[model samples]
Target: MTEPVRRRGRPPRAQQDAGPGMRERILDVAREEFAERGYDKASVRGIAKAAGVDPALVHHYFGTKEQVFAASIEMVLAPALEAPAALVDGPLDGAGERMTRFFFGVWDAPATRAPLLAIVRSALNNEVAAGVFRGLVASQLLARIAQRLDLPEGEAELRASLAAAQLVGTAMLRYVIKVEPLASADLEWVIARIAPVVQVHLTGP
Candidate 1:
């Protein structure tokens, strides 16, 4: 009998390890790789190696390095993205408090904090990562906030930038730097102090 013919292309490596959660696994690995190496250095091949899959598989799942990085950012920020919606239904006066609570709620959750922290830390030290982080935050988070508020294009971006600066600064102090009382303070206490500042940034003249 003639020997069975082998497949023309490389055998399916991802299928060998593939299962219900393979995509998620790849995303998780990609996030870590991007965080550790920054956007410029992180590669599909490396991510695939770390994820125990083939480079082609990474390409198959996520078109390019930029796409993978974008997916990773979305995954990390999914919970926090809900913050702007708090502005939609409530009185404008309480919008800041709602937004603040929503922002901290995600950070306080242990499940999401690790990847979020990784991105923040990496962004701080790596210019390439910082550019990616800034683009994602501006496009995804800040733009949503500006849209919800219905401000003029220029003013809306200004307001969004100010709000982001306030929250990001607070996060750096409370979570990253672990400043004296802010870090150790109750969440409500921190919220109380921060809400007004954010409120001013969002709504003040």
Candidate 2:
């Protein structure tokens, strides 16, 4: 042996020109891919190949396909952080009703509805997406609202969850499912009818 080849740490040729926002690009591509293909059939390698980056980068940013699904979801779902407080605070006498109306109003605009419907459809069809959906709804909307209401013995969670089912189901039928009158109706008209029901869900014993 004349000499031992020494390997020094250096950038690999594959990773040399990885562009900025590469991870985000992969996620964006993956989101569409997952939406189109659903979770089971969507492939990480295919997403990376389309994204023009190494597969490692995908794992680096998102860890796994499941994690990628979670990342994809953050784009769609709005966490109900400020809304609950805004709904409860002393702006109006019918706090519960106002809260309900405000909550529904959040998804009324296209900006809110677009990502939401995409994610909902994906989750409805895929278990991985469903888990992600469940997690986001629980953490952001349900738990926070429960805390705000000062619910006792976790009863508030059931109340909030039932309310969520109603609201989510309505969104599904009207927006995603595109069921007749509910979908065709004007926004305020829809809000007027739904607000009281949601108010009862919030304040009911």
Candidate 1's residue-wise lDDT over 30-65, tens digit each?
999976786768899899999988777777777878
Clashing pairs in 2: none
Against the reference, the lDDT scores of all candidates come to 0.81, 0.71
User: Model 1, which residues run further than 4 Å from truth?
Assistant: 1-20, 35-42
Model 2: per-residue Cα lDDT over 52-166, one tens digit each: 7767667766777888888877755544444665666653337556765765676677666766666787788888779988997788767766665556747878877777777
Clashes of each: 0, 0
- Angstrom error of the Cα, residue 75, model 2: value is 2.6
Worst 10 residues of 2 by lDDT: 4-13
RMSD of 2: 4.4
